[model samples]
Target: MRYHRLTPAAAVLAVLTLSATACSTKSGTGTDTAGSDGVKTGPGVTETTITLGALTDLTGPYASLGRSIVNAQQLYADQLNASGGVCGRTVRITVKDHGYDVQKAVTAFTETEPNVAALSQVVGSPVVSSLQQEIEAKHLLTLPMAWASSLLGNEYLQVIGSTYDIDMVNGVEFVVRKAKLKPGDKIGHVYFEGEFGENALAGAKYAAKQHRLSIVEQKIKPTDQDLTAQVTALKQAGVKAVLISAGPKQTAALVGTAAAQGFAVPVLSNSPGFAPQLLATPVAPAVEKQLHVVSPAPSFSSDIPAIQKLAKDYKAKYPKALLDSGVIGGWNAIAVLGEDLKAACKAKDLTRDGIAAAHRKQSGLSILGVSHDFSDRAKPSTYESFVHKPSKQAAGGLVNVEPAHAVPAARSYPLPKS
Candidate 1:
């Protein structure tokens, strides 16, 4: 759980590895030759070309989500490059689409062999689960989009925000507190199968026990586009409220079904199930009033200086884009990468190990209004140790959530009525 800051020499090697391993698909080769000053310098080095790659779902079930994320990451990269690049090094991102399939994700990762110092925004649990071993073996640090809690224990993987478990627990607790729900309140949970669902379910169960709430119903599946059956099941059970752990499509379906069935209890969802773009779609106007989403970072409407700057720049470049979790999540991941790159370059080494070491020494750095000290020896139980905001719909169908809460991992919330 404790991370030791890398020594000067170690930092140098990490940067060196990062520069060398970034994108030599055929064989690992250093693009820059190191000089006596300990900086790698060559045509590539002088150009400050750092080859980075992203594993995105540009053409599959998650393509809509993936495209926004890729765009946001591109925006971040462009901004960084325009501002003299990270640590005086230019960053080039090579994005590969895995179609949200585990096998395809493995293929994408394999294709990136001998290249790509780090992986970002991978979309699904199956893909991440497949790549876990390779990531560890290569010491490739992963910034994941999937929020399954199981990924937290991996040393090579550092999630940028809250895990699904933390989000669910926090969400349930918040609703319970706000609703003034007491012990024995009936809570229902609906989720997809796999790690994502299990994590949320685990968190809900924990919270229910902690708060002495009764879980009246639990419905799960591998994938369901229609939630009529689940909603019917929950209604029959007479649950007080429902906690959902699902992707956008399913989440929308559940809300629609719940509304149609006249089940008006409050609904809480984890990060995966919440998307601002969903609000713009046909589903938004109807579900906006009844649904509440927990976000790991500041809301898109957040007035934080950094978040505002990001939003302004994002809109100026991509005028038609809607600011969603995918966009913000991708932006945040790339920002972390940029910060680590800056620190590594300051150390004059651009290797994987060096970057990881730099990350360890980065203390008190703020991102998206959340401050974290990676330098700490204590391993965080939940990445949500930083502040989290619950997003709700604003006037004109836009997201108008404020940054009002700072729930630590130590805090526990009551369970939603089952």
Candidate 2:
């Protein structure tokens, strides 16, 4: 699942479908499998390489997100391969595009499934939701980039960040504290009708109840062009704040429309709303003054050294790709994959089952200073988010408005079901 927190990078896939032994001018000496140091081998493993699959949106609304993810996956694989890839096997990612269409995603996955050991990334919430039965039946190991909380409990889907619902709780609390909203103050929630929006609404409701705030809600369709009516309802509610659980375009529409109406309300948005083009929109001025976004990972401009190095390497590798926050999902997936690979290697069982078992053992693990720990996989992942304010002048263009905020309200929410 991709960019679900922010843009659809409006999601794209392919162009760098890594081959098992290809060497690039930029990345020297790619995959070549050596004997696994006495470890047991898995289905996708050959003597010199391990094949992985990716199903992402490449030619649809989320194509930009998918392309960024693809770039990051390629970059990580190159680095790993250069470093003598996981357990002496080079990582090769075979990607197929789903175009943000559920049926296409399912078809792509079905076709790709038999060729790989595990999935590298899968990017759409609706697609993932629709394929839950297949994912469970097949026991596919995936690092879902989608933000839906409903998928959190699946053992096979090692999520890249806190579920969308958890992020909303963190976001809601952040907004409440920053806005100084007291009990009885109303907050308006405008979201998509899909899982991403519904998950965000869950978190918002949890947090609102905890803080004694009233929630006024409106649901929108994915193809809805006009949010004028939605904004009107929120404005009429005399809401103290607005929570947007839609993608970048919807975020812009909500903020722009509300600002034009002179509602002057603080708007807190879920992760998918973080699009660079927002700064270039007519709503840019309003976004700068009123919008705060919740993110799953640190900005590329993070002060943390590991994150800084990641940013440097990404820019050097994907010179033309935008410095998107979605890269964190790719990096995090690779990082966790590295861990599972390490554990599997150590256990002398480099199979899909071994990787899944290893993942179950992670605790207090984090990546690039933004992702929360995957410790205690038997329980849902920890809930934490970075609250960022938009400023065109800022590095990565998103300035942290709050310290790394953890969601206490997660305890009150139900574990989302498949």
Candidate 3:
């Protein structure tokens, strides 16, 4: 596993405080009651403290992404607590650093068992895969950051955003339609070798087929410092478009290399490939002129009421850090968790069973503009999973392309040729 030392100042602060509460239970009428089996019996929970855990990459290679999510989760928790919490009870979040390692993620899961009612924001695909069985065995509901299609059928996991493959397809389709590219247009892809990369490649292939275009070249690797070779390959193939599905560092390298090679094809990126820091790096000027990214939410600079409020509050609290999409996604995840807890605590008995039951019955909960209605039939569905595109706005801001779309399932798009 890769290790990156976390500056002590970047450490997360944990706030834990307990409050005593008492309330009379409604008599009879099939109300919930505590049973010998440790399950609460009732219509649902009334007031109860629910402990949620976040295993994030607070001090690892994905630190930038993970830290923003941690801050957003805390912000949501603070907002909920300020509003009297859910169902008269307070919600507490326990955060642990997985260091972006699969093994450490497993260890973090074991360590957090005591307070883990649900796990939110598990940051990497390998880590999520490692914990899949454990999560199901413990009956722990999980909200994952990784978007591998392998996670699609899991009963214990609820993916809350567009998966990698879907994002690529939507992004490519939008660019093709908007650019009016015709058949025989050549497209290229540069991606990593694992699930993250494969998912993007799959989407590109699918889109190419649907539009009767061709993938002129494909470059795959496990890791690289410079993508000069990949860029050279794409350039030689005479491709008119390129799709990249790598992390921020590699993405920066690709953009810089592509620019240096004088390859100016329209470049589309997966979610992580669009980190603001990457755009702010020295290579940003070139990227700004040539890069386009598919976003899962409105751009960070959107004036939409929800984003505006979040940005204002975040800046007020963390003046040094620029608000980014990952942070907003984290906030959304926590908001949904708060809503689930709220629904769970509406009954007389505040217990695990009651909370789960409440979540199972959730309907019409809104977060920002997205509406989530989970029922017994949709127990593992996520609250926000649509695909959005972020383009530069005239006033020096990023905004989502109008008419954002969603892919309800992995197969929603045509499968790529093997």
- TM-score per candidate, chains pooled: 0.84, 0.91, 0.83
Model 2 C-alpha lDDT per residue in residues 375-408, reported as the tens digit of each score: 5543455666788888887656677777566766
Per-residue lDDT of model 3, residues 1-418, tens digit only = 1111222343444331212122233312223466443435332222355557788887677776776777778778778878887655556667777877888888877766545456657888888878888776655567787766567655456666555777776777766865578998888888888878887788778878878888765555545767888889889888888888887677778888888888876777777776655544677777776777775556655556887788888777666665676677788777776766666555543444444456556567666655655453222243133333333332122445543465443336643321
Ranked candidates, highest TM-score first:
2, 1, 3
Best prediction by TM-score: 2
TM-score, cand. 1: 0.84
Quote the lDDT for 204 in model 3.
74
- Taken over the whole model, the C-alpha lDDT of each candidate is 0.65, 0.75, 0.64
> Which residue ranges in model 3 land beyond 4 Å of their true spot?
1-11, 14-48, 216-222, 347-357, 360-363, 373-397, 406-411, 414-418
Clashes of each: 19, 29, 7
**Global CA lDDT computed for model 2:** 0.75
Best by lDDT: 2
